[model samples]
Target: MELQQLFLEAIQNGTMEGFFKLISYFQTQSEPAYCGLASLSMVLNALSIDPGRKWKGPWRWFDESMLDCCEPLEKVKAKGISFGKVVCLAQCAGAKVEAFRSNLSTIDDFRKHVMACTASDDCHLISSYHRGLFKQTGSGHFSPIGGYHAEKDMALILDVARFKYPPHWVPLPLLWEAMNTIDEATGLHRGFVLVSKLHRAPALLYTLSCKHESWVSISKHLMDDLPVLLSSENVKDIKDVLSTLLSNLPPNFAEFIKWVAEVRRQEENGQKLSEEEKGRLAIKVRYLKKFSKLKGKKKA
Candidate 1:
């Protein structure tokens, strides 16, 4: 069934699935000129794309380090990433993506396509942004839609450039006009599409490894923080804290990295860790028992 029919039928039959699909999304952080990449990241997470893959042997992993982010966006020099570049990079990352840009596509056709695409959980959609739908001054931009609200004729746009715009409930008709506008940069239409991972298992495991790395990352930061705490505190309980922390250090940094990567796969959703992330993770784990503290001593 097409999304338009699905939503209509769901509403007629009194079901809510047609209107909502909860997914994760994050704002573009630090990379001022990477909204395309940021939008890609949001869609990847929304669809749970793992971005990692296995080699021919199924035992060896493909080296993800060779994936140059900027190389794919070759058209983007100092300007924002073009829709074409976004498609290229996403294809490299193993995403199933398509671009919708045709002068022949009428407003009604786009309305149905957008409604069908955003109405399903299997679909992850993103498109260009403007001040009218988003209330932002800039017109040519990229963002994702969480789902659609048929009753209200609104589409939930999960804007990736969160620093500049919060997510909004945009009317589908208005958003369609925004998507159809010609981009002078590429002379292409601005619209979103459904994105999903080509490979499932490895990507999921890769995601899990990230969460594990976060857990391990906290312990690694303790390496830098512990020394400071020990030196600055006159509190007598400090010795016990130091002893406990030191004892918790990984026996060997390399071994810990190997062990963490090896075992992390068994973790819920975390089935694998990238060799690059493993190396960096190990570097952070090195000297987990070391650090300094300074304090101003005020006489009582």
Candidate 2:
């Protein structure tokens, strides 16, 4: 198979060997403005679906030397390459944040890093991760761009965040770590925007917490503000949370319906609830004793 085909297939099957071959292929090119960007994105897509794959095989080939050959943003720009592709490539190689930071020693390097992190459609935590990885010189504290330019860029970050993507719908533990990190960095605590970014891990967390109100209460304390930012339209994507909540709530469909009505009312009024809130409400409805009797009444 051609290298491109091999790369595409490797991404589909999550094979480390194919990725290794692709990386080898990537190294041969001296003017890798476009190819490097594409190759990086492919690597990201492959590893994101299976982060564990990085533990061995082709992933190991991506040592410091390989990272060094990547072209700087300006060099890529001067060569007329699309900066977006560069962002995508770094993102794919899982080197986005790190790549930008590694080069942030100069004022120009810092500008590129800021632009990459705040790029629309880029994940904020990824930006945060990169910033955290490469701390500023002679500064014990980290700030998300404290100057005028940084402030301007933050507006762009918030705007990009509002552009919603389909739910990730996968289960991942690392997402939890990301959430905790965001909490510490922003001091915002409990909002759906962060959970939504977790892709599919929110479902898992909701499931575990639903059965234990104590657990639910504790986690909610940490992340309750999520629903406030989510739209009713997006609530449909996280219906699984509602299903779990309904399953565990006290048995009373009427009361459950009432709760749904309340949430629906909030949703209608432009309120957003996190998966936890939706799940909590769903379980309460499912457990309603009225539902059990309704089953018997149908038979009678």
- Using TM-score, give the best candidate's number: 1
Give candidates' CA RMSD values in order: 17.1, 20.4
* lDDT by residue (tens digit), candidate 2, 1-300: 443453344334332222232223222223323233333333333233222113345352332123322345555534523323334334333343343322223334434443333332222222222112123121011112111123222111111111121112111122222222332323332111100012333332112212122433434533663344343323455575565444334333333343333343344453466787677656654564466565457546
Q: For each candidate, what is the lDDT?
A: 0.55, 0.31
Worst 10 residues of 2 by lDDT: 139-148
Please give the distance, in angstroms, between residue 11's alpha carbon in candidate 1 and its true position after superposition.
10
Error of 2 at 65 (Å): 43
Residue 205 deviation, candidate 2, in Å? Answer: 12
lDDT of 1 by residue, 1-300 (tens): 455664465456333332344343455533555666676766665565554433344432222222344353333435777777777767766678766764555667655655676656555666664555546666677776655656666666666667876666667778877776777877766665557656544321223222223445555656675567666655368577766555444433333343343334333344656797566545544422222111111111
User: How many residue pairs collide in each prediction?
Assistant: 6, 22
